[model samples]
Each structure stands twice: as C-alpha cells, then as structure tokens.
Target: MASIANKVYLFDRDKNLQWTSSIDNLEDVAISADGNKIIAVASNKVYSLLVDAPEEKFHFPVGYPDAEWYEHESPNGQGWMTYNPEPPCYGYHLGDDWNAKPPPDYDDYGDPVYAVASGMVVYAKTVPGDVWWGNVIMIRHDNINGTGVITSMYAHLRDINVSEGNVVGSGQVIGTIGKGYDDKLPSHLHFEIRYGDSETVGIGCIDSELVSGEQGPQGQIDPTWFINTY
Candidate 1:
C-alpha cells in the first residue's frame, strides 16, 4: 500500500522492498474496492500485482505476441519515434500525432472483455457520449471479510454484452475495447474496481471508511482483491 508514484516496484507482504525499476510514467493506481488487489497502468500495458503474491518476481514489457505502440523521443530533439520495446524486435516511438492522418483500424481493438470475478451488474451504459469514458459497466462482488467487499468496473467499451441487474460469472464476456469517447485515443478498455456502491465507481475518487461505513451508493473498494497476479 505504499504510494504509487512514477516507478514500478515490488514489495514483500510485510511491505519490504523486493525490487524496483522505472517503467513508463504511472498513469493510475487501481486497488480493487477490496484491499487485497492492485492494477497499475503504465503507458499501454496494465500491470496486475496482488499482495498475496509477495514472494514472486514481476516484470513489465508483457511478453505478448504482437507489439503495440509506445512513444519515445530523440535525445537531440530530431523527432519522436515509435518502437516496440520488446527484445529481439527493434521498434521506435512515433510522435504524439503520428496517427493523426491514418488511425488504427477498428479491428485493432481486441476481443471479448471478461469479468474479473463472479458479480452482480449494478450499472451498465451502452450509448455513445462525450464523457472521458465511453460505454461503462459496474458490478458488486461479496468478498471474504478482512478484505471487505468490492465493485468491479469496465469502461471505453465498443460493445456491451451484458446489462444492468444481470448476474455474471467469473470470466464472463462483458464488452469489447473501442475508441475513447473523444475518438482521439486508440481503442482501449479503462477497467477499474472500487469498494463502494455503483455511483462511486470509476469517478477516480478513492474514499476511506468503505469497510466501516454504511454500505451506501457512493462508497469504494480497492480492486486488487480479484485480479490474479502471476
């Protein structure tokens, strides 16, 4: 539970330092509404780390089969470059507006987005709009005590496969990644988990007292409780 700053770090369950290094700038630190799980966003990839997995080593540059876009700048300001940081492959970072003329295809957005765990759908939105987050969904899960309970969320969906009031099982397909509501950024899913009611979901407002408060509509839970870190 150390403050999530710009660096990527590893720690033991006792909060002892295990390893540390600089990834891309840390965008956000999402803890499952429960207190046991965490997902940190660094540039294009999401790193899921669990407090339960304190003894194992975790590294970035997820070894996916394909290389995604990443930004890098020249030392002398010649220009920005786009490259795959994945080893054995040499890619460069493209400038900020590199894809302004020809953007990535819709199909570039990948397949089925799944539920992190079994839960009840408390909120789901499918229509297009101007919000920073496009289509979004929120679910509530009952976790064991000590971690309290949690609420899971998925956003920026191209398609919503589930509806409000629906009960879903773990790994259920809920949506697909799509363009941001602004149509500027590429297709990506803005997934999150909070520990309170549906209204507090995805608002980026982390509130304490969720565990002790009356389970109201705006409470929050950390997101780390459900994600499996490997």
Candidate 2:
C-alpha cells in the first residue's frame, strides 16, 4: 500500500493497482501481514478498512449508554473549563475538558473513560512528573465513511485499562478519569481529537500558536464537534 498526493493505492504482488482510496490528504498507508486490512493516515485523521468491507463509526469518550456528559463551557458554571480558548482566560485550549454534570469537583473522579471508536491503541502511558496530562491514551480509528482517520485522546486518567497496540471496540472502557500526576487540579478528563500522527502525545494546551485559525492548535480539532459530527 502507498499514499501519494493525498491518495492511497493498493497493489497486488505484480504491482498492479487493486484498489484506490476515495479519501484525500492521506499521509501514510499500511497493510496487515495477511493482506486483509488496510490502514491509512490523513492530515487530521486515520482510517482502516477490511479488504472486503469498509465502514467506521465513533462514540463519546465518557459516560455510558447515552453519554450523559457535558463539556466545560464556562468557569462560572458548574463542571470543568476554568480556562478555555475563548476570552476571559484566553488560553490555547486544544481540546475539550469533559466533566460529569451536577455536584462538581471530585465527584466524577475514577469514572470510566471509553474508547470513542474501534481502533488500535497507539499510545498509552503515564507521563512522569507531568501534572497536566497524567495518564494518556490515544486510539486511531479508520476512515469514517471515507472521511479519513481520526485519533481520540484521553488524558488525566486515573487508571489505564488498555495498553498500546490493543485493538479496542467502541465504548470499551480504556481508563478512569483522574487529576494529574500528583493529583493536582480538580478531577476531570481532558480529551482531544488529533489527526495525522498517532504516536505524538501533545501538550494538553498551549498559550500561543493556532493551527486551525482561532479554533485550536496544530494537529488538534474540537472534540465536541468531532463527537457530534461523527
């Protein structure tokens, strides 16, 4: 498999083209040893498809059944988001800080963090001496209806249930929410949706640099928009 000019091409042993991906901005491509599956990475997402079937889906990283969770919208209101990308505290918030509603502060601690989609765990480890990220897990999901690949990152986790290279199913519990390294800051899940590279564990946020206009930093997208759209 090879990706060039935003296209992915699959060829048989004879080098004859067997299939061409309809998606664009594909940065890399790989095939399983058995040649039964193909995984491709785009500028802001990743996609994998079976040789015989092609489909993808996504889910919320927190909450169960109905995903009864909400993002931190304001510092004055209940739940997380004391600092955001918007005014007041104009920090370069790259992702959404998810929190369970009602009776905030440590109430949601240790809550299970789920895999938003079926994919391989590309990165999972606790950052040593880093109080902002704590435990982080990144899952790379294949193309969503031919829209390229997407990665889901869960941070500030209390416990990591899944390891790197594990293929997890959508909604599978991968970890539990927690405060940072030394339990600094209030308990909440700092979640992000990154594209392109799946192995890089980016700084949760930055004070400078905007990747997508004023939306977010480079390689990151709005977690709320991604969850609702996909």
Candidate 3:
C-alpha cells in the first residue's frame, strides 16, 4: 500500500478531466469505494468533494475542540493514542514500541498537532495520569448528507488550543504533540476518522488495526485516500 504522503491518480470515468491529489504533509485520507468521493486533511481540517456532486457537497466545517473527556474501559487501565500516518519517513515509529518511553530528544514531545478535519470542538481533556494517550481532543465533523460520517479524534496532544463548541476552519492548529499518556512513545498525534459513531474504532499508533467491537476489522483502508483528498 502506498504511504499517505504520495500523490495518487484519481480517474473520473464519467467526467473528462483526471484529477491528481497529493497526501504529503496532510493528516488523513478518505475515498469512496470507486474513488469518486474524496476527502483529505490539510492542516486542521478536511477538504472533500464528490465527482458528481457540487461544491456544496463538501461537508467538513472549520475549527472546533474537544468538549468532554473519553474514558474507555481497557484492560491496561485508561489510555489514549496518536495516529500520525505519514509513512515510515515521517511521524511513523515503525519498530519503536508504543509502550516504550520516548528518547531524550522527545521527552517532552515533538511536532505541533494539527486538526485532521474541521468541525466543532466537542471533547477535550488534559488529565495527568493517562498512560498511552496524554492530552486528547475529539472533534465532530458534520456530515449532514448522511454519508455515514461523524467525529474525528486527535489524541496524545501536548497542548490543546480551543474549547468545546467552538467552530474552526479547515487546516487549523489545534494542539501539539506531547509525550503520550499510555503509549509512552515519541510525541506524535493519533488521528482517527470515526464512521457512524464513537465507541468503536481502531487501536495502536503503529501497526494500525481496525477495531470494531471486541474484534478488529479484517483490512486497513488505504490511508492514502484520506491524506490525498484533503
């Protein structure tokens, strides 16, 4: 699979022009089954458009921070994660274990955190004791079209800038990378694009897994899709 940073070709069979998009330096990638619907993260928000749909079809809002804190029942106690999927070149700590404490250069955290997609700040918290995910923010992206999309989460932040209910623009700055609370690894952002609702999603910073219920999903969606579209 291609890393999120590489540019991909989008062929609009019905349309004449072939559009090209790059995912380099972007946050996430979203694509419809046939490669028609496209959404990609630029800075703090996502940009999206359907081949047959008008510009109004682009639904992601600008800025918003996390309002409430999420406490999941985990066997290892409460923890959070960062999802920086820029391939093995950037942000990715491939052989590095999530449970290992970051080296001295990254003791405090590294890299400023940006929003994956624009939306309202619905949940934010900076509790001291979290082991895997330190400071966290979860924004709810509005998908009014009922395309089956909702909030996206930015976890393990070193600092959060906005509060709850605030509206932010696409590609806005929300936070910075901090020492992860639970993972205890390098400072990086954990990004998750939630479909339908929360409570069910993937896990781990690297070796990303699709977590649905007690079991993880079978395959990983090409991160390239979400990173390229925005």
Please name the candidate that would achieve the greatest lDDT relative to the true structure: 2
TM-score result, candidate 3: 0.44
* TM-score against truth, every candidate: 0.44, 0.68, 0.44
C-alpha lDDT score of every prediction, in listed order: 0.46, 0.69, 0.45
Least accurate stretch of 10 residues (summed lDDT) in model 1? 58-67
Model 1 per-residue lDDT tens digits across residues 1-230? 44446865667789899656455666654444333455555553345555463332111111111113421222223222222112111231111111111253434354556666545666788534446566777766554233345666666567878776665544556776666565544554544545544533334322322343233234432222223331
Q: What does candidate 3's lDDT look like per residue over 6-45, in tens digits?
A: 5645555565556676655565554532234565555544
State the lDDT at 192 in candidate 2.
84
For residue 211, model 3's alpha carbon misses the true position, in angstroms, by: 10
Per-residue error at 139 for model 3, in Å? Answer: 0.9
Candidate 1 stretches with Cα past 4 Å from truth are 1-110, 126-129, 144-146, 201-226
lDDT for 148 in candidate 1 is 42
Tens-place lDDT per residue, model 2, 144-217, is 54546677888888999977766666667889989867787678888888765467776765777464434444
> How would the candidate models be sorted by lDDT, starting from the highest?
2, 1, 3
